[model samples]
Target: MSKERAQRRAEREREAAVLAAAKAAEAERHERREARRRAVASRLPKKRRGPSGVLADRRRTQTRLLVLAFLVLNVLVWLASGDWAVRILALVLTALVGPLVHILMTKN
Candidate 1:
């Protein structure tokens, strides 16, 4: 009876070891498959934006430059005249003119 019990315990240990080895092998295969996928993706070329995106980018840059120029002009107005009301009015107009022109130009 003692010999039979020893044999059964040994068999259970062997089965558990086999199961652990299978789990390890499956995880290694998954890692290798992921590596292969990343390598293939790296070899593909990146896609670029279309013409509409280019046009939108150009409009963005133009609007940014217009705002920068308006700020500079506002500073110049304040430096030259030094009046609170005049400076405030110039600043408001400077801020409004760019978007107004953009609206007018893009109106359909």
Candidate 2:
């Protein structure tokens, strides 16, 4: 019985050692992959958008907002008025004024 117990203890120790080795290998592999990724990322070019790019983005945002506002206002007008003539008039006015509004808002 004592021999059997000793054998079982030895088996358990062997399994523990194998598991520890596997864990260490996995940690090493993870570190290697992360290092490679960092090296590649460091080589990539950094995007530097200057003042013109910023201004262009701002103008684009303003234009989009203006278009959204125009659409919402047109919808409101259509809902508020039952007359077809009033809806048509609203559409015409929006078409005429939209470009002017865009130009004024986007002008530097």
Candidate 3:
């Protein structure tokens, strides 16, 4: 009976040691991951001024191009179709909706 109790106690101690080691290892891994995340976050730019300005300029240029295209298409539709009602509707639709479409599709 004494020997059996000692063997059980030894087994229990071994399991506890293994659980403690695993917990310590998991904590170390978490600390390392957090350190790496902080390092990467620090390296990235916090504020973007130059790129945003350039992008805005490009968007303005693209918007102007879309407006031009919409105008040319409207004129073409009028000239080719030669129907007053169709031309009026097309012009109104293009003038009203073209800018909105341009803005929606624009990417920064």
Candidate 4:
């Protein structure tokens, strides 16, 4: 019958419209996710040290500064503190454990 064919055509049109809307929504969501990823990536700090050589250089520079600051602080402490026990303790610690703890404690 003509009415039956019309009903089937209408049903197919509705299904096609639903499928098209779903596809459009999925594409929009994908685009939104990509834009968000780009936004987050833009906020990150740029890595300056590419390859192994630059990284080694950075480590060496930091280590050298740490050692220099430690030595300077130790000399100042040795000159300032008058208590014999404290001075003796400093000397003993310097001889036994080296400058790392002394440097860390000097901040407090």
Q: Please, what is the whole-model Cα lDDT of each candidate in the order they appear?
A: 0.84, 0.95, 0.89, 0.77
The residue pairs found clashing in candidate 3 are none
The prediction achieving the highest lDDT against the true structure is 2
Quote model 4's TM-score.
Answer: 0.44
Task: Name model 1 segments beyond 4 Å from true.
Answer: 1-52, 105-108
Off by over 4 Å in 4: 47-49, 52-108
TM-score on alpha carbons, each prediction? 0.45, 0.51, 0.47, 0.44
Candidate 4 lDDT trough over 10 residues, lowest sum: 99-108
- Model 4, 12-95: lDDT tens digits are 999999999999999999999999999999999876874468766766566587667657766777789877778778667656
Q: Please say which candidate is ahead in TM-score: 2 or 4.
A: 2
Of candidate 2, the 10-residue stretch with the lowest lDDT total is 47-56
How would you order the candidates by TM-score, starting with the best?
2, 3, 1, 4
- The worst-scoring run of ten residues by lDDT in candidate 3 lies at 47-56
lDDT of 3 by residue, 33-52 (tens): 99999999999979765545
Residues 24-79, candidate 1: write the lDDT tens digits. 99999999999999999899987887557877777777768767777788889999
